[model samples]
Target chain A: MIEEFFLRALIAGVGVAAVAGPLGCFVVWRRMAYFGATLAHGALLGIALGLLIDVDPVFGIAASSVLIALIVTGLQRQGAIGGDTLLGILAHAGLALGLVALAFMSVRIDLMAYLFGDVLAVTWSDILWIYLGGTAVLATLALIWNTLLAITLNEELARAEGIDTARIQLVFMLILAVVIAIAMKIVGVLLIVSLLIIPAAAARPFARTPEQMAALAAAAGALSAAAGLFASLQWDTPAGPSIVAAATAIFALSFTFSGTLGKRAA
Target chain B: MALDKRSAGTGLLVEAKGLTVRFGASSALDGVDLTVSSGEIVSLIGPNGAGKTTLVRAVAGLVEASAGTLWRQPDLRIGYVPQRLSIDRVMPLTVRRLLSLAGRSSGAEIVSALAEVDAAALLKHAIHDLSGGEFQRVMLARALLRKPHLLLLDEPLQGVDLGGQLALYDLIGRLRRRHAMGVLLVSHDLHIVMAATDRVVCLNHHVCCSGAPESVRHHPEYTALFGAEAARRLAVYTHAHDHAHDLAGNPVAAADTNHADNEPEHLS
Candidate 1:
């Protein structure tokens, strides 16, 4: 039944994991974990802004994260400061701004819900949003997979091949922003990057190619979602953190088995 | 310098006139005129920071020329092997998958491409796991997969051993003969590429001198750019085996055989 909040939560979590798995591969490959964190941290500010302006929180998070991504991109081009330092500034500034703004809000916003997602409280509409957004992200990612891989391997070579690397980079950043916004509800803003990074990292040792890695990552993510949900139900733990823990466990297991598998294959 | 109308008539793969590339306030490449015709090998030689890499990048369309006109044959396919390719460890990419990036190719074609550079054994190897020489061979294989009209090789010999360098040069010569593709090679030492290249373009932010390997070795501009001592070394290397007696007691050009003897110390 739509009224069964746990069912709605499970569906939403799985949908988000399925998309995050492949997209997370790019994040890990490009070493954009900090970038992902920066965007996720900025989403909290978006939530506060959404509350102030009486707009949907998802829309607010997407707007603020995209804005931060663009700002990061522009500052990187200026070459005034190094990338990690720039991300650190934006990441902390965003989190600090969000906390301060929340303090000033007249409405008693349930800050805990946004900080660590309340997946068990999800509604049927949340499931619809997850599936629709997830599909769009996955399809676009599929279309640009080769180009993204090419760019990631060597920007100069990709440019020489006449691939529009700049356009692809813009598209990638926007997709990351959207994913972080949608994923905020599943793992919360604090742990959103774990959803994007862990499963992909876990999938690496077993995969011989990029496509294999992406597919395996998606499977790992889905498995984590299902297992984390069940674990949360059994242990009365927070769903988002439980999911991340399950993904971590899988990652650790991968290290143990992958070596033997690699030896056998060799 | 006047453009060679003869090469233009025959078919030029790439032509750049006054190609200048500026990075921020400084000029990386300045007022360079160059051309690569079908089936020709053009070696670009320059000292470090002399814009040799920048020139190759400009021709490959990786960098835009700040003030120049560059032309390529319409629909020309270019296979470029960069001086260095650093694959992230996290990215799971095998040699076969890398070759597929140019477009889809049959498994046989992939094998043949790898075999062309004597790297067939690396078909399933992860790119990150490859040693420097192995990585270069795989990169060459990736470029060969395109069956390109032109090949831009930027310091393809950087990390290769002496024997591997000779093999790569032989492979390049074979590719030129077999595919008739124009090749723009960048190297630090002109002596090594002298035998294989049809013309050597010496660069120091601009064209110092360019002509047949022998002439460029003697060109005053080249002498000035590289100094008289280096020029003498290059000339000796070029003329060292110009006349040789084969088993039949007939004079033969042993340039190819003598290539190993003149292996530049820098390369070693």
Candidate 2:
């Protein structure tokens, strides 16, 4: 009953959302929303450079995000400057440099498509990349899940218990970078962090444990993807923003159930 | 390695000889030699800028030593209760979930660990909602879940009421006896600390004095560093030891060489 292009878009969007849900919880837990924003901004530069070099944009995005992650980690270790200020600076610079590079590129590219995402234009190859790359990301995340949770809870505590915290942190950043590389096609640069965090926040009101929160976040994100896709079709709206809007709506709606988890939070 | 007083079997869990840790140019811990053997409670006491926390971290292998030899028993399992471990509100966590972080712990094991800390009912309670004393009990439960050979507790009594501190210290004493574990306690409170400590190492960037709890109180370096008033207040929990106070005189002389400029600054 559905056209193939619409079906492809649904599959791709839902796939990205499922992966984003678990990783997004870490983003929220670690209070790294600005860090996520910084990585997405750096991802834009990756896309521009990829087109310039005539290589796969996924590779460029991964490289750029990972490089930004390393720089942030290094700066945190030095810890001489304010962390949020440094992140704000890097985020703006990455965005400005990316825009300048995109303006100078010779190839004809739709700036709006990369800025807000063009989910309807995704091809079979893009869907393939989403599933394959996302599988690798999720598996790696599972491998480091407990240690990552430990570090997120307390880095010093993890190190005290014989965990190699620095290596675990670098590995977590790499996973975040890979997620950015794949999910960039679905939510685009500007609203990518919303896709990563909103669903996790929505699930928090119901979850009583970390694993439950992660599983609930994935389900919430998937439901949001499906709902946002249909809403876009009905209203003839931009697909990416529609998905983010749907997620925000769910996040807002979840407050009604706040007492479920909130009553015990004090 | 030569500082290792005994093998792992005999429970010389961690030993440091002339260990020095530097942050840039300033020395946090200088020429520190400390050791903890089985069934021993060694309390590290110092002022605000003292490297007490740093020494605990170093023994737990968190910080790299710049100089001197630091050795731990091979395959040493450590249970470390950090000074500050406030679980963020954003995290949805129960006491049960917190203990499970120690890996492979079961429901029965979790319950028992909580029972060991006198907080058996907190197993299902949300960690964020726990009172300061309750949160500490839960953290101790988590650490106990590791079944560690060495327990490193950094300021375990912070934010706790004095009555609650005595209770907590009692719980720690029972756990140590039952598990035969070595305890490395870092604390700033003198009144309650001397009551619980078997040995006290007064530290201020270096080892000022170390001996039986009562003996170290009268040492010149200890009195000079913490102020004589602190030493007098610490005498509140006096207990007779086999060795007399003057037995610590030799280490006091050695320790004074590094901080000769620091005279006894009596409390005003």
Best by TM-score: 2
Q: What does the lDDT come to for candidate 2?
A: 0.81
Which candidate leads the pack in DockQ?
Answer: 2
Residue B216, model 2, lDDT: 38
- Model 2 residue runs over 4 Å out of place are A259-266, B1-10, B194-196, B215-268
Lowest summed lDDT window (length 10), candidate 2 chain B:
B236-245
| DockQ values, each candidate | 0.58, 0.72
Which pairs clash in model 1? none
Model 1: interface root-mean-square deviation in Å: 2.7
- Candidate 1, which segments miss by more than 4 Å at Cα? A1-3, A260-266, B1-9, B104-108, B214-268
Of the true interface contacts, each candidate retains a share of 0.90, 0.85
Question: What's candidate 2's DockQ score?
Answer: 0.72
Worst 10 residues of 2 chain A by lDDT: A257-266
Docking band of candidate 1:
medium
Instruction: Please give the RMSD to the true structure for each candidate, in Å.
Output: 9.4, 6.4
